[model samples]
Target: MNPGKRYLFAGLTVLLAGCTQPAADSPPSGIEAVYTDFFKEADTDRSGTLEAGEIGASIDRDFAGLDLTHDGVVTIDDIYSKEQAEPPGSTRNPDLSSHLPYDTDSDGRLTAAEHRAHLLKLIGEMDIDGDGLISFTEYRVTRRF
Candidate 1:
């Protein structure tokens, strides 16, 4: 190979190597390392998505914490009201936008169907190859995580 070509190849190799190195705080390399415990905890029925019954316990706790009026249900109104009520820089405030995707009907309420659909959608996005399964490389490349 020509000397110029060799130098160019070496430069490109060094740059690529630096780019591939994981950050210090990066999660371990593999879907299992990152999601095994979470999947086990959330996938109560062993189904990929967390269904209504499976989500009840965790959702109930989150709902109770966010229900400012102590109402039995959590509505979009409650989230907005809480956001407006919280002072700037308050860590107590929740990012209500995260819940919007689950309100599929846009009725301002999160139903089990919506929740399940949302989770399935996330899984679909993570399955980059459309193989119905997420690999470590797919998870790492997924920007949503």
Candidate 2:
């Protein structure tokens, strides 16, 4: 109710707003790093390629775990639905659900094959000039402020 208190609240609000991270739907600032991590984790055979089967089981499990309705498939909306349904203070990380926007197909589910394709497509888009690879400059420019 006091002017000084109001100004203090406003300043605190501004600082808090600036400290918040970008929404998950926004383009990530580490697209290249994401690619690297995905490649490393999913390339089970060390062959520099992501075989469909390598990620298949995990994909199936992710769908089964999130498909609370038992509909045999999971949708982007379902991820948020479950998030909201979670009990308070549960330790689940929501970052993985950020992959939704890149799901090209509207099937509301992503298979291992789809995940591989999506990552490749994302790399291509970020390449800008079709260089077939991401340079540090391109990576920084694509993901930087």
Candidate 3:
């Protein structure tokens, strides 16, 4: 092969090799799964946390359709008072007031380190087995509102 062709092939090979390596901060599949499930379930009121109920209630009251009986109590059937379910594609932050406050830096984005620390803390809180692992049931129970 010509010298130019040899160099070109070598560069291409290096690039292809790099594509298969695992990412530097990639989380384990199980941990990621737990994070996803717990976040979705625990953020029940969708206010972000448990405490967002008051804020959500205020917003609901302002909507015309919320008070079906006009009695000030928001029943399940009262569509106006209901908080919208979380959207499908993105992870929404739970209301901070509900349970624990998020440790977001002033800029409003979760740094990689923050994300990892949060996950570890959650695992520690939810792990009931004493084996340093969180079972699915334990995870579910801990995340319940």
lDDT ranking from best candidate downward = 1, 2, 3
lDDT of 2: 0.59
lDDT of 1 by residue, 5-119 (tens): 9999999999999889567576554654556455456556665554446545544555566665675545666777766565677664244446565675666665545555665
lDDT of 2 by residue, 5-77 (tens): 9999999999999999777566543665575554456556766543446555434554577666676555655
TM-scores of the candidates are 0.43, 0.34, 0.29
Best by lDDT: 1
Where model 2 places Cα greater than 4 Å from the true spot, the runs are 1-99
Report clashes for each candidate as comma-separated counts: 0, 0, 7
Q: Whose lDDT is higher: candidate 1's or candidate 3's?
A: 1
Model 1 RMSD in angstroms: 6.9
Show model 3 residue runs off by greater than 4 Å: 1-101
Measured on C-alpha atoms, candidate 3 has an lDDT of: 0.50
Q: Which residue pairs does candidate 2 place in steric collision?
A: none
Q: After superposition, how far is residue 103 of candidate 1 from its true place, in Å?
A: 1.3
For candidate 3, report its TM-score.
0.29
Pull out the clashing pairs in model 3.
47-95, 48-94, 48-95, 49-94, 49-95, 50-98, 51-98
